[model samples]
Target chain A: MQDQPLHEPQFALHVEDLTVTYGAQPALWDIDLDIPPGVMAAVVGPNGSGKSTLLKSVLGLIRPVAGHVRIFGRPIAQGRGRVGYVPQRSAVDWDFPTTVLDVVTMGLYARIGWLRRPGRAHRDQAMAALAELGMQDFADRQISQLSGGQQQRVFIARALVQQADLYLLDEPLAAVDATTERIIMDLLKRLRDQGRTIVVVHHDLTTVRRYFDWMVMLNVRIIGQGPVAQVFTAENLRAAYGGQLALIEGGAVDPADPHP
Target chain B: MTAVLEALGLLFQPGIVQTVVLGAALLGGLAGALGAFAVLRQQSLLGDALSHATLPGVCLGFLVAGSRDLGAILLGAFLAGGLAALSIMLITRATRLKTDAALGIVLSVFFAAGVVLLTVAQGQPGAAQAGLSTFLFGQAAAILRTDLWIMSGVAALAAGTLAALWKEVKLVTFDPDYARALGLPVLLIEGVVTLLIALAIVVGLQLAGVILMVALLIAPAAAARQWVRSLGAMVWLSAGLGAAAGITGALISATGRGLSTGPVVVLVASALVLASMLLAPERGLIWRWGRAARARRGIAGRRVLAAFHGLAEAHDDPAYPTEEGMLTTLIGRPGPGVMERLERDGMIRRVDHPPETTRHWELTERGHDRAKRDQGGRP
Candidate 1:
């Protein structure tokens, strides 16, 4: 029940003793971590390694059997407006009858309050977000007509319109073209430069060194988590991906590291 | 013509015909607005199941009240539909059965129970169940002035609720998990939407009847879906279409002899659906076919232009007037039709030899430029 300043918190996201189970099998087990503010962190893991589950649990989309998550030194509900979320690309019905502008405007729903529609100021903000993503020309286009990369950009635009301090993206780079990947990476870097924290569930290890500063490797449990230069080693990747680690040997880790 | 005019005249007069028309319109508007959510959520059959599930409650109301009181019947229907929804949720949650299976089981079982109760009520003497069977396939002529007042009140309440919660409902329908993450009371919003759907189904029973009420719930919204690209527009368009269909069916039924209102309304709604499916601009079948046809023609024209470019490249001349026979050989057979189309498009020119019937075809300057770009300076 501690009420503290909104901007100052020990960690951008803090998870304590978190364990998530789907019926009998465990999805994520007893995880504890503290993500510092203003770092672009990648949650890297193999398929079915609970990367998405971890993000969902942190966002309060899924409840853990035992443990709690705090964002900016408070429960998620207390600072709901300060957190932005971009769910997986396949999470929504793309064929739904909605325009790009309308989807972007949804990010301001929490701020707009109940029973009140978004006004011109909110719309201008959404347009600005779309412009930032180079999708302003497609503002009125139906979402279903967009390509996979454009769709991903629109999702990012929605999250950008939230103007939140902490952003959680689930596989934002998956299935996107090279240009879209670069745009997203640059946008994330700019957010970090502006003192915002971004946590993305990333798959490609090759880009981890270039795109992210911090990393969290998971295989139903925390494998390693620290600065990317320290924890993102071939050894850690082998542990997270298990024996399926092919073509990832040699020079995958930082050369300066002595952890060979 | 006179019969139609008389029916139209009767529609404006303050009597049973006018009352029935107004009641049906209100039912349609409310059901349409609520049903858009159902359609978007891909839960159209849930509305069917819930409406059919209302039958047991209607019989229970009759058995309890010992009379044909509209309020009691509606309340009974609401309760039964709500219980059915709860049971469906339980079965789906506790077991491995999917939503469709659960809904089917609940719908038929509840409807059968209602039929048994209805027979029991009819066997007992002194019970007023004379027009009770009309709830199955609605008798518009049986509508009373009192029913209109209730219908209007419920319609206003339901529509107002939808307007007030429009944003929350949109978010939940679009992405429930994200709505939950936003801490927007996702469960409460979903529960309200479910209750409103049940309310819509209960109110529509008297007008559309239990068996065919799902048409009113789904058809108008689905039709609107074809014509619109935003949820707000779709909702309003669906409501308008539903109201129109309701009024049209009522007017038609008034003109005909011994025709029931519910089936006529369903038919009208089905016709709107068919029209929308065929004629809507972007998503309609007709529009898609037309676009595909245009694309195929364009592809053929491009292929002919590319063929011209290939012939020019082989000769290393930008304005090579290749013989018609050689161009035909390059373009594959059945080439004259495509050649004519290319000529019409101004991409190629035809040069006729005066003595011989044979002609020469060559690319125009514009066509040469296009050909060069197509060949990407390969030559």
Candidate 2:
């Protein structure tokens, strides 16, 4: 609960000069991004555009070649356990032998402390998170038996169980059923209303404005960053997605137009 | 029958056989407990690679001591296994080689070096490394009370570690990225798990040779997975299954002459895997097959009902009953039993015509609504 300095505005996430390279290829290059607290924000880009890299770098999962990240004006080291992460659904082997309740309980592993098991209170908390996501009925079901949408819900529920102040999700809506998308979006919005910051790595550009209030258009480097109304302009899309997107839309799109 | 009785009775008698059984069982249980993590982490071959890599350490331990001192050799094997695990991890991470390739490379190279070292040790004067190669396919007869104590200590350590870090290990194995996000020491947990797996492999060295040790590690867990839904159940069941297999194999070896315990134990574990796969509830092959058969029958029955409903619609009479033979001819090879099952389920019923002809069947009122729903459109 350390107070921020007088000069520093409280950004839920702040990255300064972040550059990540896999071997000779740079994934994210010299990027600076700031997302204020309590806004449903998005990291928008096409494939291989470092949307995931930004999240990973912010979480300090992948060591960036340069730059440091902060959550709420503090370095990641000092901000530990305050940020919740939902990795890509495909990041894990879904066939692993585990129950839905067990996966959600993973969020509290840090709070449960090292070497200590999750007690009944922890289980109730996990169950409550699952209930929020409408996955309470699947508490005992094995994860592998779930659909893609259910898997995404379970992932979001796991993040919710963490009860972190700042949440970073990697494509929570991708390939999910319509119901799951709405449920997750509602949950994220609820978190935002409660003054929690949620940043999503988003791919579907058409729905970006509708889904997020804050946007950071990214293609290796920052193309645009600010309110979606300002950062989601057609020109920004062209810069972020490049000719690959132009090939699909066939022309420039207006951010105010709300459709490409 | 007498042989079986003798084996069972010999297990309870106080002797070296009991010690060997206890040692093998403890090692098997430890392997099962630790292997659960390795297998869950998709590193089943890590144990295999580490076990094979323990060869040179065993040879070196023998050579250094000029005698087959069990503790020194085990320590050497433990170090070698750790080194092998580290090498495999590095090779996979630093190079383009995949995990299996790294495991294969380390396993064969270390095993070959161990073989060569064994030969060299044999050439040395005053070398008492005879039967050192028994480590290749564990010589259970060589197990002593002290070996049992070692196995017990290792098992206790594995159990304690698992108890302390069960949640963290599960989180890491399932998703390390999230574990890192939660500020858990993902790498440290992984290292500890791998180190324990290596210790388990080294302990199992005397019961299941390097060639068969992987069996003890994987079989029990694989089998337990079929019968359980939770990781806790899987690990506990796997460890228990492993212990049971160990005791059974040791007992069998005692009842017979010239049967190697390692291969016997491995065979027992393999049978457990096979049995679990075939017979475990819900997830088992037989149960799956039965479910599949039922599904196929249900689909065929619905198709028949829909077809019958269609025929009635074409005839513009909802009660239009068709000859059984015609229905069979039209459906063409959905067995006669399929329609009978539909009738039994009240979806269809048999009827008789005024003329002396074969009985006819027609969709019931409920079946008509179901068929229409299945069609998803009006006539």
Candidate 3:
């Protein structure tokens, strides 16, 4: 340890007894999780599995009934600068009166502080982030003009400008082209290789072992979590999916299979 | 109240027409700028609720002062508008009803209560004055110098806050969740923005009245959104359009004896919205129609050219001359001007028809290249 702020230095994300409710209905119940630093992770299960609820709870946007979520070895609130988020594209209004560059610039507004505006240097930084996602030419174009994949790239660019130690993305690859999917995956891997942790809410079960090294199977509660090869087995997938097993590919992973 | 009515009558006198117009413009500008945020956040009805909610406050202020005091009336209006907003939020939060139902509930209930209060206040001593009713439909000519000063002070505060918190406000309007994730005080910022909007509505309460003030709040912003693609431009244009509507309406109404300024202003604002919808450069209806028309022409031209290419391919000859009848049969008769327009653009040229009754045409090199390209490099 470098004598930094850490209750547990090994885990980049720590969630204990995390419970969330929507009105009287429990969305997530008494969950516990520990994800070590610098691993690309996936949270997978059938639809309505509390994946987005879990992420929002960790971000402190939703009020959870009971939970403690730590990021980079600190409380979620204290780790604001250390965590970046790529929310679902549906979370924003694309037709809002703003340009792509301005949307990306918003990522720096918190760091830029209040009562001050972003200047040339800040814009240059935003331009560079946009360039990384191949969206530099669209910096001045209005956001409503972007395609779904371009919109996803713009969001990833915004997150990139944060340069946080931990990143959480909700279904970035869903509905994107294979090329776009590869580009985003490569970008995430690059970030992880630089010692940052990446956690994605993924839907594609076939790519789980191929794309991630750590897995967290969640369905209202944590069915299993740990290194992908260790926790991602046929038995765990069946338990997480249950009656909705046919909804997703619960049969994708076989207990006897090797890296299929 | 008599004095206020006297002031209204005085503005019609030769010297102060500009003063009344200026006052109305300021009111419109303030409403328009704040309304930009309200419209963006999809809470335009919130303004309606807040404005109507101020009616009871105006009655209370009149009762408490025993006379018409503009400052007391404004403060009371501010508080009441704020309370209405809070009530709407609470209604939506405490129950499953969405914002629309909540706004409607607060608007009608608060306005009905105020009407009842107005009747009660009419019976009390000194509250029997007639000018207090001007707050319902609004009489712009009734604006006093003190009222103008109060409006200016409120406008200044709004402008100052918007300039200082421009980034946060834009971000909050666009994505409050992301703003919160970035450690911004999402709730506090939202609250402040909502309060500023309420303040703007309160200030416009007397100028446009409770009934028509929401037009100034929503119309200008809605119109401006059609013309601009940036929040900054939308707000500025909204303010300008609002001011324009205000001045035109006030001038027109002031020319007539019984015309109320509020309805006239709303009509002018609505006209501007209609104009923006029809004529804005990119988002306008006419522009979209024109673009669609041009696209249709291009597609038709491409198909005609591709038809020529098809004839050349079928005959296994590169320089085949196709008769008009044959071309028509290949793809149903091209529109009458389709061939002429293509020839005018130098994509095709007519040839003399020998031993044939119809005109024949051949594609120029340009037309041939285009035809080949549209068909993905085919024959």
Candidate 4:
């Protein structure tokens, strides 16, 4: 594990007893977690695990039924510029007419504030971020012309241009090819190396060990979270993935078993 | 020609030219900007349907007021158009009926109702009923300065609202989910955009007529889409294009002896759309094909270099390979006279063959190097 220099004790993200609902159904329930600064952690769960909802709740995208979120010991509003997000590939209309460079430049829009145009310095930063993601050649190409992997890379580049301290990426690897995945992983690691905190909503559990240093196993609730070795136990896995019925059957769950 | 000139003089003397141009330009530009959002939302046909739906309102306005004043008619048109849009929204959300079918259904039924009322209005005992027919086909010659002022105000208001909420509108248009996740009020933004569209259509009923207002809403925006990538640029360019279309339509309809203004304006707008669809920079068909052709040519040039590299790897042979057979096999039938083209351009040399026989070809070092670099292959 890479050593990160610690300052005063301030968590990068703090979600205290958060609960969210969609009509009558509970999307997230009593979730409490504190993410330390400069760690790259993954939120792993099944399809209905409220991963996206949890992220949205933290970002104030969705109103929680109960609880609060703080960034760097303060509310999210005070650290708005310190948080950058990369949405899922399918969430955007790929046929949008904007080019890669145009999309990437949108990250600075909030920073550049309203009505003011982005200047050469912003463009240089955007291009540099694009180059970091190896998307420099496709800067002028319309988003529709890009393959799914390239579009994911372009989105990651957009996030990189934000220069945020804490980055929240939603399914950044979904629909991406191997090369794009590698580039994105490398970029996340580089950001981590720079003492920036990253929280990724990731799907591939098998590659979790290879890509992320910290893990949060969630199924509508946080089963456990910590260093990989501490949180990757069979007990936690069963608690995260197993139902009460499965727990009654055995502590160990079979992958082929319907109960598991 | 003399009668036409006399009529033009009469039209201008009455100050109809300034009225129609200013009215059409403002209304059409407003519709164009709001219509860009509708177009991006895949709701262009919805505006078309609502424009036709506004006819029933126009007829009802005439029946109620017994007057041909623009305000009464526009108010009625707004109600009818708003009803149509709401109905479409309800049907789409409540049932399996698609947006296009819902639009078609509303358009046909409302248009039929309007036409029936129009026929009834023709037999009514009022001179005001006579002017109602022009709303169906738009007599631009009849627009007064007051009407132009109304349209200019509507355009100014709509444009200002759009400009003020440009960021939220763009975010909502492109990715409502992302906007929602950002805690942006996406539904409110969509409501504002739709309200602007309704306002635009209600105003366009006077300038381009109910029957042709859809053209005013869609054509300029669609044309501008082919030219620009940003919503702001598209709106600005669409406004300019709409103004140009309006002026051209006004000039031709004013100068021509018998041509109606609405259809002429629609036709001119359609022509601009056609030109943009074929020739505009980004999304134009011609530009896409041109780019694809260039890419293919580049790939072919790479293949030629691949063959050269293949030959270079074959042996340290200064014979520099010769055989039209192997070149054909290597480059895969180089487009009719492409081999001859390569030879003529001095990129490839042909040697050891009769004038008619299959000639062997080899690349010069310049061609060899160019192909390798183009393909990102070894030199």
Backbone clash pairs for candidate 3 read none
- The CA lDDT at B95 in model 1 is 84
After superposition on all CA atoms, how large is the RMSD of candidate 1? 3.0
lDDT (tens digit, per residue) of candidate 1 on B34-101: 88999999899999999999998998888888788788989999999999999999999788799999
lDDT of 4 by residue, A52-167 (tens): 88888888877898988887866665556678888888877787767888888877766775556679999999999999999899888888889999999888888788788999
DockQ scores of the candidates: 0.76, 0.80, 0.90, 0.29
Instruction: Rank the candidate models, highest TM-score first.
Output: 2, 3, 1, 4
TM-score of 2: 0.95
Residues B1-379 of candidate 4: C-alpha lDDT, one tens digit per residue: 8755664565456566767766766766677777777777777888889889999899888777776756777888889988888888888877778888889998999889999987777677774545787887777777788777777787878877777777667767887765554445677778777777878887777667887888888898889888886678888888888878877787677777778777888899999999998998757899999899867765665676567667866876644765757767766776645566566767777666556476676678777667667667443
Model 2 collision count:
1
Better of 2 and 4 by DockQ: 2
- Name the weakest run of 10 consecutive residues (lDDT summed) in model 3 chain B: B1-10
Candidate 1 TM-score over all chains jointly:
0.93
Q: Enumerate clash totals for all models, in the order shown.
A: 0, 1, 0, 1
In model 2, the runs with Cα more than 4 Å from the true position are A1-9, A250-260, B125-129, B314-319, B354-357, B377-379
Q: What is the lDDT of residue B73 in candidate 4?
A: 78
lDDT of 2 by residue, B173-220 (tens): 889988888888889999998888888888888878888999899999
Candidate 4 chain A, which ten residues in sequence have the lowest lDDT sum?
A: A251-260
- For each candidate in turn, the TM-score is 0.93, 0.95, 0.94, 0.77
Query: Across residues A33-67, which tens digit of lDDT does each residue of candidate 3 receive?
Result: 88889999999987888999988988998878886
